[model samples]
Target: MTARERLRDYHAKRDFGRTGEPRGRGAAVGDEPRFVVQIHDASTLHFDFRLQVGDVLKSWSVPKGPSGDPRDKRLAVPTEDHPLEYEEYEGVIPAGEYGGGTVIVWDHGTFEPLSHDRKGRPVDFAESLDHGHATFRLHGEKLRGEYALTRFRTGKDESWLLVKGSADHARRQGTPDPRRARSVHSGRTLAQVAGNS
Candidate 1:
């Protein structure tokens, strides 16, 4: 589907005049697919993980955020498709609006699709995701290394697992405390961002 069609749900849930979030003009796709992890201090704090697929960013609300440790299986709940411009979004979403909260760009960078088929043939990244699993190597300011998102459940309680790959970049250290983690874009914590807004 085109970006406009994919973003219908996103647009329906948000009011552009009330919120500062991007309305998702057709931004140019980059050479490599991009990924962003944004910390949102909404009703319940969570990390917003987004991966560029075609013209839109397929998003997931990762409760504990992505980790560098392969042992940690982070729960990722699928959300709406976001605009490409959301990668640089960092500020407070006005009160009473959809997803009203403070947001900060925790990590943003390009990713190399690493999904492969049963016979070891490389599969299209979007196709891989449609099949409920996709692997990729993230080259971000803070998060570097390989990661995979695998769907564990479907239907009413759909969810996916975000886990780091057991590679050279894997470390014992997991995700940091959400409250203490600072934005890689502005080097500001959630509290600071909320305070400024």
Candidate 2:
């Protein structure tokens, strides 16, 4: 099973609030994983949202970035699932292409999900992303909390918000200040690393 494949499976049964809206490509239908997330600062200024599903990555692009708190809605737009290999995607995306600009693996790590279906067991992430609210219980050293990905609009995979819905006393329950999260690629920012690596 690939991420793209799983994404397709999840949607086959998803209500999506409407029909034929192209919310996602409805690729491979498979099981969505728990606590899996990857952030990619794209060729443009947008940040990519990726959750593990099957063998590929269920993806989206966030413009404002991830929130550390539980109140801020950091718009997350839905996008097609990229191969797991995409986790390593960095640099520029050519000058005249679909996304022509500089793409830096600004930061990369993992995230845990805490959302469940109406039954409250755990959400089958792959299929549930279309539900519009993805509750993530992050376990990463840098980001730890009960967070969420909410759909804010219906633009070109560039129209959603990654909202931090709630948090425990250990984590902020709202928006996180960028200064609080140090880059995870280690000591350097993505650009610095790309230049040197």
Candidate 3:
């Protein structure tokens, strides 16, 4: 399906007139696919992990945020697809909105799809994701090296795991305190963003 079709649910959940969130005018794809991790201080504070798939961003709600440590297995719950423009979003979502809260662009950068078939042939990143697993290397300002997202459940209880690969790029450090994390775009924390709004 096209990006427009994939974003229907996202659009339905949001009222463009009231929210500052983008209406998702399809953007031109760049040479490399992008990934972003946004800290969302919603009713339940969490991280939103998004990967560019086709023209939209396939997203997930990561409760504990992403970690640099290889041993950290972060639970990731799938969410509606988002617009490419959302990568730059950093502000407060109004109260009573679908996701009313403060938001900050925690990290974002290009990524290299590393999924391969049993024969070692490069597989399409979207296809790999559809099959419940995908591996990629992130080149973000704060997050680098290899990572993987693997779906562990499906249907109503669907969930996935985001784990840092145990490669040379893996770090001994894990995720920082979400309240203390600053936006890569604005250098503001959730409290600061909310305070300004």
Candidate 2 local distance difference test against the native: 0.54
Per-model TM values vs. the true structure: 0.97, 0.63, 0.98
CA lDDT of each prediction against the hidden true structure: 0.93, 0.54, 0.93
Clashes per model (N, Cα, C within 3 A): 0, 25, 0
**Candidate 1 least-lDDT 10 residues:** 167-176
After superposing candidate 2, which stretches have Cα over 4 Å from the reference? 1-44, 152-158, 170-183, 190-197
lDDT tens digits, residue span 1-197, model 1: 78899999999999898888999998888899999999999989999999999999999999889888899999999999999999999999998988999999999999999999999999999999999999999999888989999999998888999999897567789788999999998899999999998
For each of the candidates, the C-alpha root-mean-square deviation to the true structure, in angstroms, is 0.9, 8.8, 0.8
Model 2 Cα lDDT, one tens digit per residue, 1-197: 63445557445543445322233433443343422233333354556667666666767667666766655667666676655555555444434444544444445556666668777788766556667666766555455656676666654544666765553643444333322333444444445534553
Question: What is the Cα-based lDDT of residue 105 in candidate 3?
Answer: 94
Candidate closer to the true structure by TM-score (higher is better), 1 or 2? 1
lDDT ranking, high to low: 1, 3, 2
Q: Could you give me the TM-score of model 3 versus the true structure? A: 0.98
Residue pairs with backbone atoms closer than 3 Å in model 3 (clashes) = none
TM-score of 2: 0.63
